[model samples]
Target: MNISHLLRQYEQGHRDFPELNLAGVDLSKVMLISVNLTKSNLMGINFSRGFLTKSNLSQASLNWGDLTYAKMSESQLIETDLTKANLTGAFMVKSVLRSAKLSGANLSYSNLRGANLSDANCCGANLQEINLREANLTGVNFNWANLSKARLSCAVLKQASFFGSNLTDAFIKEADLSHTNLEQVNFQNSRLSYSNLQGANLQGANLQGAKLRYIDLREANLQGANLRDADLEGADLTNAIVDNADFTNATLRDTKVIGTQLKPQTIQKNLSELQLKRNPNYAGSFELLSTSYAVAVFNKDNSLSC
Candidate 1:
């Protein structure tokens, strides 16, 4: 209670400093705008370059807190623990941080535009180059998070997990990330344009040269997925599994292999040149195919897989 009697009782305006302990306080570059400091322990507190705009700091512990270059726009920080917090280059526009814990947090290059951070845990978080445009981030866990070059355009990220996550070259345009786990996720050279990723697991995911235009990926799994040189123009891939999927030199113009349980001679022995746009005994008929060096081999009692 001794930052000069909490800045002389917050300069005689006394904005409700609930349970304020302020352990290890430095309070560098302090402004403390609209401050509440609710349930504050503020362990190892530095709050580097601090302004803390519209600050509440709800349920705060702020373990190992530094908050480097902090502005924290519209901050509430609901359910805040912020374990190992550094928050480098924090601006945190439109911040709510609902259910925030942010395990092992670094948050490099942070902007966090329109931030809500729903159900946030952010396990092993570094969040390299973080911007998080239009962020709601529903059900966020983000396991092993680094999120290299992260922007996350129009981000909602429904049911997000991102196990062992790096998200190399991540932009993730028009993002919803439906039912997201992103199993074995890498997303090398990532763009993810028009992203939905319906029922997303992305089993064994790498997605080399990943742009993934017009992406929906209904019933998505892509078992053993690599998708080398991936383009997937007008992509839908309805009822998708694609067992042993590799699709080398992948471009897939007008791509939507409806209810895909692939076996047109395993796309002609690993796609030496298969261009049947329709009628390969067309099962209730579907194909907008134009492939190059493709490999799809799903036939485990296929009628759109189990």
Candidate 2:
């Protein structure tokens, strides 16, 4: 059916449109609330500014469609194929997108607060500045995705794969990222305070200048991770592997780390190397008082004092 015919039918109180093949259609700014478009083929459709709230789009193919600024809140998009679709600035709050294919999609500035995207393939998606606060992202594959400046506070991200992702400056406070694979992720300057990262794989990840205060890092791998200038105050790192991990100038005040294998010189050299590289006026007379709650004395000449 044509767009005009569909609108006429909708005006007559008819809302069912299942299995409809509306490929390449221009349905921009159309109000399709509570419409059933399940199993429909909507590929290449221009749905920009469309109001599709409470719509049933399960198993639908919206691949390569333009959903910019679309109000898709409370919608059922389970198993939907939105691959490479432009969903920028879409309001998808409380929506269900379980196992949805969103690879290479541009969801920048989209508000997915309280939404469920569990087990979804969001690899390589551009989620910059997206607000996903309190959303359920469990087992979601965010590999190589750009989540810069995204807000994921209180989100359930258990077993999520964020390898090679860019989460710089993202606010992920109080989130559960247990057993997640976060290798080589760029989390520079990010705030993950009070988060549960127990048993999470953060090897080779960059946590430089990040705030991880009061976080749970029990049994997590930190090998080769960059914690330079990062704050880990009051964090529980019990039995966490810190071998060769750089903790230069990082705060470990009241941080728990039972049976850590990192040598005192190796940990201290992290600071020495950074100071030497950044500044060449080192006095070479530094002393680390303790490793548990790391204690270091500094001099007025910009040198570590005993």
Winning model by lDDT: 2
Q: lDDT by residue for model 1 over 20-90, one digit each (tens)?
A: 89878898998878889888899889989889898899888997899987998988989898888998889
Give TM-scores for every candidate, taking all chains together and pairing residue i with residue i: 0.38, 0.88
Q: On a 0 to 100 scale, what is the lDDT of residue 186 in model 1?
A: 92
Give the C-alpha miss distance for residue 23 in model 2, angstroms. Answer: 0.6
lDDT of 2: 0.87
| Cα lDDT of model 2 by residue, 1-306, tens digit | 888999999999999999999999999999999999999999999999999999999999999999999999999999999999999999999999999999999999999999999999999999999999999999999999999999999999998999889999999999999988998899999999999999999999999999999999989999999998898777777778877889776766656665455444444464543332122232222222234333333443334433
How many angstroms is residue 36 displaced in model 2 relative to the true structure, after the best TM-score fit?
Answer: 0.3
